[model samples]
Structures are given as C-alpha cells and as structure tokens.
Target: MTATTQPLHGRVDPAALPRHVSLADTVGQTMTMAWRATLKMRRNFEQFFDVTIQPLLFTAMFAGIFGGAISGSVDNYLPLLIPGLIGQTVLTACVATGTQLREDMDKGVFDRFKVLPISRIAPLAGPMVADMIRYFIAATLTFATGIAMGYRPGGGVVGVAAAILLAIVAGWSLAWIFTWFGTVGSSAQAVQGISLMVMFPLTFLSNAFVPTDTMPGWLQAFADINPVSHIISAIRDLANDGAVTAEVGWALLGCLAVIAIFAPLSVRGFTKKM
Candidate 1:
C-alpha cells in the first residue's frame, strides 16, 4: 500500500486568532454594525410604523377621547397628555428592539456572527444605537401631533428639546432590559408578549393617562412608586415649565441604575448564547 500526502490549503490557525481588541477598534466595529442596522431599517420601511403612525394616531386618539373628561378642554390637557404620550410612545418603540433581536437569533443570524472577529457587544449594541432614531421619531411626532392639535408647550424650543432628549435616554436605557429578554426568549412573539406584560402596567398604572389621585388609594400608592411615573413627571416638568426638578434627577438616577444592572446581565446572557 502507498501512503498519500495532502498539501496544506491556507487555513488560519485557531490559536492565532485575536483574543482582545482595542477600544478604538471595538468602537469602529460597533459603528459598522450600527450602519448595517440602519440599512436594514431603510429596507424595512414598514418597521417605522410604531415610531411614526402610532405616535400620530395615539396622540390624536387619546387627546380627543380624554381631553374634555380629564381637564375640561383639549387645549388644557395637551400639557399633561403630550408628555405622557411621549413616554408611552418611546416605551412602545423600544419593544420592537427585543422582538427583532429575538427574530434575528431565531433565524440563526447570531450564529453567523459567531465566526466574525468582532466584539460580541457590537452586534448587540449596534442595533440598539440604531434604534435611537426610532425613539427620536416617536418623540418628535408626539410633539408635532400635540402642536397640530393646538397644544402649545410653555417650555419653548429648548425645553421641548430637553424633554425629547430625556425620553430618548430613558428609552435607550430601558431597551437594554428588553434586549436581555430577547437573548434568552424562545421566540420573537414571546419576547413581545412578555414586554407588553411588563409595559402595560408601567405605562397605564401610573400617572401617564390620569392623575394618580383619581385612582383608588392602593393603586395610587403603586403608581406613586412606579418608575414610569417618575419619567412622565420629569418629562412634564421639562415640557411645561422648562425646569429640571427632583423628578428629573430621580428619573436619570433610575436610568443609571437600570443600565448598571441590565447591561452586565445582557452581556453575560449574550456571551453564553454565543
């Protein structure tokens, strides 16, 4: 018997692969991934419905329905309604981030990412960063809808801008929690359903729609403690008075706490999946 020898085809050595990347390189890679996500959103234009159509529709619907009943006039209610709707819209917009992430994972997209030489956080953070555009859209449209409905803000342009900025920051911070859910969820639908379960109580049970005083004593107690209440109140303070109050500081502190907790959990969960 004759022994045959095979020639080595050019294959990379596994041991030679990079184990760590510089911060600059990681940031560059993250930006590249973010660009990819932006392109995806462009192609899937309908994905903007939550940020665009929902804001316009919900703002009109709520203002029309609750305007007279809540504050005696739509004009009078706009200040309260606008801020609350902005918070709700931004929070709802964030739900899509997790659903899409779950879908990508289900479709084995993350499997492809496993072979790439990039920071694992890039693929996760990129889509989140890109989703900020959606948050901004939701915030802007909510304000525009309020304006078109004769809801003038007292805070002027600077206060309105600050309010939008706060919503975006809070939305981005909350998205991390949902992103962690996406990493572990069984399906896209499951992630969305779970997110809604958590969001409905936060959005509705608080002072978003009605005054906490109007609610029952026990429910008012819960609403007072809810973090969503703090966010909506903070936004209202900025949009109505253009003042940064204790509520705004509390909202920001809550955001920082959320990031400090969920960011690490999300990274750990995601790495395990990889």
Candidate 2:
C-alpha cells in the first residue's frame, strides 16, 4: 500500500469547514471582542459621570443661547432644536472612537494585541463597539434636557424611542469613518485634529442650527444635500411631528451605507498596517 501524503499541520481549508463553524470561528469571535470592549465601558462606572454631564451642558448651553437668538423661546425651539442637539451629540461621539484608538495605540495596548491569535479586525471593532455607550448617554441626556425644557414629542413614546434608536445607529455607523482614520493616521494628535476638521464642516454646514433656507444661495444648496441634514430632518420628523416619512427611510439607508463603505476600509487599513 502506498503511503498517503500528509497535509500541512495547523492548516485547514475554509471552504471545507462547516458554515456554522466558520461563522462561529470568525464572525462570532469578532463580535465577542466587540462585546468585551462594550463591557469595559459598562464596568467603569465613573466614566459615565463625565459622559452624562457634558452632553447635558451642551444641550442646555446651546438651547439657551440659540433659542434666544433665533426663535426667542427655549420651549418653542425645543421641538426644532432638540433634533439638532441629537445630531450634534452623534457627531461629537464619532470623535471619541478615533481618540480612544490613538490612546490605545500610544499606550502600546494594540501592540500587545497584535501578538494574539485574535482577528485582525478586533482592535478597530472594539473601539467602535465601545462608543455605543457614549452615543446612548449623549442621546439620552439630550432628549431628557429637551423634555425638561418643555419639549414634547407629538409621536408619543414609540416615536421618541424610534428617534433615539435612529440616532444611535447613525452615531455607530459614523464611528466607522473615524475608526478608519484613527487606524491609519500617523499619530494620535493627527487623528484628533483630523476628526475635528471633518466633523466641524459636516455639523456646521447642515441644518442643525438655523434653517437651511436662511443661508446664502450656494451654501443652502449644499446643506440641502448633506446627509447630516437628512438625519436631522429624520430625527425632527420622528421626535417632533411623529411622522415617519420617506426622508427617515433615506436617512437610515444613508447611515447603513456609510457603515458598509467605511467598515471594510477600516479593516483593510488595519490589516495593511500589520
């Protein structure tokens, strides 16, 4: 009898593996790492204090200042501006993903991770996942402040819940863009600075503060087309009017599109750096 040739040790063909096993080995492991990162935020309770306080401060500060300048009554603008605050919070939360990534990389945390058998995407995925807490806190405080200031949702509890959920998904999806930046940037300072540059224009140019129609012709045109504006409109529609429209559907689709595009880019960037 002829001796059969031996296959390579520790090498398995992915195609030969059962579908469930492949998913468990790959996707399940990535999700577990992601969940662990979220758990890190959950167990560190003190950090929540800062996260909760800052968003409230911004909500109150902006609501007071802008309400007077634009529409006069804080209560009146609550319906209009609450969505703006939510959008602002979501945009601000995106920065933390990059900042945390840089902190981890600078502290040699990622270098340690690199030696493990974990998926290459874990480092980027972890920070993106952890930031959901920040999104939740900011969105919660934002709406709470709005309510305290006399903003009532015409759509009732279900509408309010839906708006909050939409804002969270938007925030999480947006974080992927920053995650890509943080993973590939040369330094932490670069990541932080770049994040600000990208976010500032996106936030300010949209219909977050004043009506887009009030702007100059060209600027108004751009703002009208901005994805952020669509998101703000969707949130406003849900929170204030309780109308679920095509605009909301478009906003959700846009967010998912962002995630689909940037998440793969982030993963590739991480793998290339390795």
Q: Candidate 2: give the clashing pairs.
A: none
**Per-residue CA lDDT of candidate 2, range 1-274, in tens?**
9986637554444344333334455666667768877787778775465457766887788888988788888877788788887887788778877777777777777665554555666667766666777777778788888898788988788888888888888988888888888878888899989999999888999998889988999999999988899999998898887889988998989998998899899888775665
Q: After superposition, how far is residue 111 of candidate 1 from its true place, in Å?
A: 1.7
Candidate 2 versus the native: TM-score?
A: 0.86
Winner by lDDT: 1
- Model 2 residue 164 lDDT? 89
Residue ranges of candidate 1 with Cα displaced over 4 Å: 1-19
Listed per model in order, the count of residue pairs whose N, CA or C atoms clash below 3 Å is: 0, 0
Local error of candidate 2 at residue 241 (angstroms): 1.8
Model 2 worst lDDT window (10 residues): 12-21
lDDT of 1 by residue, 146-168 (tens): 99999888889999999999999
Q: Rate the local accuracy (lDDT) of all candidates.
A: 0.89, 0.80
Give the poorly placed runs of model 2, Cα more than 4 Å off.
Answer: 1-21, 42-50, 112-118
